[model samples]
Target chain A: NAGVTQTPKFRVLKTGQSMTLLCAQDMNHEYMYWYRQDPGMGLRLIHYSVGEGTTAKGEVPDGYNVSRLKKQNFLLGLESAAPSQTSVYFCASTALLGATGELFFGEGSRLTVL
Target chain B: AQSVSQHNHHVILSEAASLELGCNYSYGGTVNLFWYVQYPGQHLQLLLKYFSGDPLVKGIKGFEAEFIKSKFSFNLRKPSVQWSDTAEYFCAVNVQDYKLSFGAGTTVTVRA
Candidate 1:
């Protein structure tokens, strides 16, 4: 079973361009999250959803928006990309949050904004 | 505000050598800890996690971590390392309100 899958494995966007990264999961999880991984910065939360149609800001939420209109998909959008927004984005899903259950992650989407 | 810290930015070890990567957290209340490994070009996978009960948790690939509440630390350890162990490891802590804080990560290289 495909636990979590991210679209656009690699992307390059010009400054001021827009794009959306899609995350899909077959685990039927209740929680989904978007995160960015930087060189020495590890992973920082960008946005999250507790369930379908709900989204919340995370640690590093600037320059990004998220939509969780469906139970199995979470979309992260960049309205206007910037050079500083270049990073590897990851999508994750969990059966439950605030619980001990583990989170399953997608391969990741590498974005380079030039 | 809770935060996670991984002291080692990079680590290199010979095959069959013991390994330890330091991870610390700053949270006062109850917390759940996790260690995730990201191979060269793969997704992040959980190595282990700590919720309650046993502080010493064993995970896949012979990796384990001990949660020391007093020191606010959950350190990952492996008895013997191999060339395949080369990867980037991350430590995270889930505090109140269900947000996870991750460390800067540690890169481990095992030379055969």
Candidate 2:
């Protein structure tokens, strides 16, 4: 069904470089989220979009930026790659189901910054 | 701020053994709880969720969780486990913001 797809599954970047991770979903969900997964840190939210053209910060939003110009796509960008930012990033979306919606997640993007 | 905790970092069991994973969340208001499972090299998938009404909720793969409001805990349990059940499990809490606060996760290994 191609529920949620992420581009550039793996990437290696040098410190101070920039890159963007693209998340696309065909489900047409209204809420989209970007999260980074690290060892022992679980999955920490980086950014999220409630709807088209609306973006908000999450728990770990310091080194990341996100935009949701379109409903089906959410873009996460790294302005300046840092070694501490090396982790696996995931994208997720959920349809409006009141307070009990479940998240559908993408495969994830693995990033390594040296 | 809302947060979730998974006490068991790793658990090892043989096939057909019972399973129990502890999960706790810190929030004063009403919340929606969820358990997600991630298989090796796979994305996270919902195992089950608790919204309201019944305190005990059942999920896929014969998994169930009980929501004890007084204890602020939502523990996942299964009567029997298979080798294929080996995966990483995570507990998450949503305080009506649509943003999930996830626990560190517990790794389960089922030996055949």
Candidate 3:
């Protein structure tokens, strides 16, 4: 099963450019998320959606936007790219249970903002 | 505010050596713990998780972790390492609202 997939594995952007990263899941999960990984910074949450059409901000939501229009897809957008946004971005989704949560992650999108 | 920490920034070991990596989270209430591995040029995959019931959870690839509630720690361990075990490991804590806080990650290098 192609549990989680991300499009455009690598991309380079100029400052102030806009771009979108697409994430798709085939497991029919209810929760989707966006995270960025940097040296010594871990994978900080950028945005998340509980279900289709519902979005929420997480620990680090600045300079990023997310949309979940379909149950199987979540999109992350960078309105104005900056050097700070140059990091490996990962998309993850999980099936919702009562309290416990488990995640299935995509390969990742390597973005470079020059 | 909740956060996760992985103590080992990097580790090098010979094949067949025992492995232990420390992970800790800062959360007052109930929390979900997870260990994910990212092999070179690959995606992150779940190694194991701790929800409840038992403190120790075994996952694929002969990996396991012990959850010590009093210590607020969930340390990952493997009885023996293999050359194929070289990868980056991440520790995470699932907080309320289904958001995961990940650690900085530990890079493990196993020499064949």
Question: Where does candidate 3 clash, by residue pair?
Answer: none
DockQ of 1: 0.75
Highest DockQ: which candidate? 1
Candidate 2 docking class: medium
Question: In Å, what is the interface RMSD of model 1?
Answer: 1.3
lDDT of each model, Cα atoms only?
0.93, 0.94, 0.92
Model 3: runs farther than 4 Å from truth?
A97-100
Please write out the lDDT profile of model 2 over residues A2-96, one tens digit for every residue.
Answer: 99999999999999999999999999899999999998879999999999999999999998998998999999999999999999999999986
Q: Please give the lDDT score at residue A27 for candidate 3.
A: 96
Candidate 1 lDDT for residue A109: 98
- TM-score, candidate 2, is 0.98
Model 1: runs farther than 4 Å from truth?
A: none
- Native contacts retained, all candidates in order: 0.70, 0.57, 0.59
- Report the candidate with higher DockQ, 1 versus 2: 1
In model 2, the clashing pairs are none
DockQ of each: 0.75, 0.71, 0.63
Write the residue-wise lDDT of candidate 2 on B1-112 in tens digits.
Answer: 9889999999999999999999999998999899999999999999999999999999999999999999999999999999999999999998887688899999999999
